[model samples]
Target: MAVNNMAVQGKFITFEGSEGCGKSTQSKLLLEYLKAKGLDVQLIREPGGVAISEKIRSLLLDKANAVMNKECETLLYMAARAQLVEEVIIPRLTNGVILLCDRFLDSTLAYQGYGCGVPVEGIRSMGLFAAKGIQPDLTILLDLDVEEGLLRRGAERDRIELRSLDYHNRVRKGYLDMARKEPARMMVIDGSQAKDVIFTQMCARVEQLLS
Candidate 1:
């Protein structure tokens, strides 16, 4: 279909996982696939890229900001999300684009609420408010063992990555909990496999959904 002629039944799909789980790579692959199939697609990531949001992202990722409190970090994430939603996601969706987001509100819940031991209720409420009730049509959680993921990433650990192993464990558990809670909306994919295998499984899942 021509991009301008496409109806605005936009679908939001998110790729999520701990560091080094290939969320970025998979998101890019799916985005390319959709575009090749003649679907309108938009690619975006959280905490950065957009002007105000990029500033917040830097703060979130900068080790100099290490003194930032857990609640504050969560709030900053929500702030960036709110701006992202208003400036990027909502507009693209309204224009009939398939949104392929690298990460979404789920990351905040996994990292902040579970990993940092913040209250889940508060985090959920904040996320809902920030997103204006917009939830992804599908969330692909690339599941992997925390230790394996960390080891695979090697020396490429960033600020968020420098967090304790226990924190990552909690985040992984949090993602599993979310999958259990929202089985229809979330699919857990094994990330220990080869990239092509993972991509094949993802394509299968998307076909099932779009069929």
Candidate 2:
């Protein structure tokens, strides 16, 4: 996949991994830390950050939409991302805001590209087009087993979460492969560690980025 890995003006960091990898928690923690230091920061999530994107998120996550076409689902995600990047991400970052996003292009590559069998090149083209050259400066991948991550999510599951174990495994492998290819921009953290330890390591990464 020929992804446009160009660096944007401000610091943009994204968190990625399988569902229920504690990224939400870690993101919030990092946000709190940045705020304490009085840095100008903005936090967001994929597929549901902005109002328009939130609507698309509901359709994508609804279990009743199991029959949704893979390509269609993929496009819907890109639509949400396009709106988010236009309405929220790009503007704030243009003013030099430090962005701590919960997820980004990597999720699509892992879920739809690897999980649902969409070609990486196609997803790359569509995603880069949608986001308008925006790319994270750093991506922290919280690596974990599919089973354990799902177990943490509990009985309630989204449509994507209900996919087969093999599918989830492929997604995890896809993330690892990306990390291997872009070690400087993507760090794979062991998600099985204690929450505090994980956060500490995450903080260290963010510190390095900020410094």
Could you say which candidate leads in lDDT?
Answer: 2
> Candidate 1, residues 23-123: lDDT per residue as tens digits?
98899989888899998888899876599999999889988777899989999999999999888887788777789899999999999989999998999
The TM-score obtained by model 1 is 0.94
Residue 109, candidate 2: how far off, in angstroms? 0.2
Badly placed stretches (over 4 Å) of model 2 are 1-8
lDDT of 2: 0.90
lDDT per residue (tens digit) for residues 32-112 in model 2: 889999999878998889899999999999999989999999999999999998898877777778999998999999999
- Top candidate when judged by TM-score against the true structure: 2
- Residue-pair clashes per prediction, in order, are 0, 0
Tell me the whole-model lDDT of each prediction, alpha carbons only: 0.88, 0.90
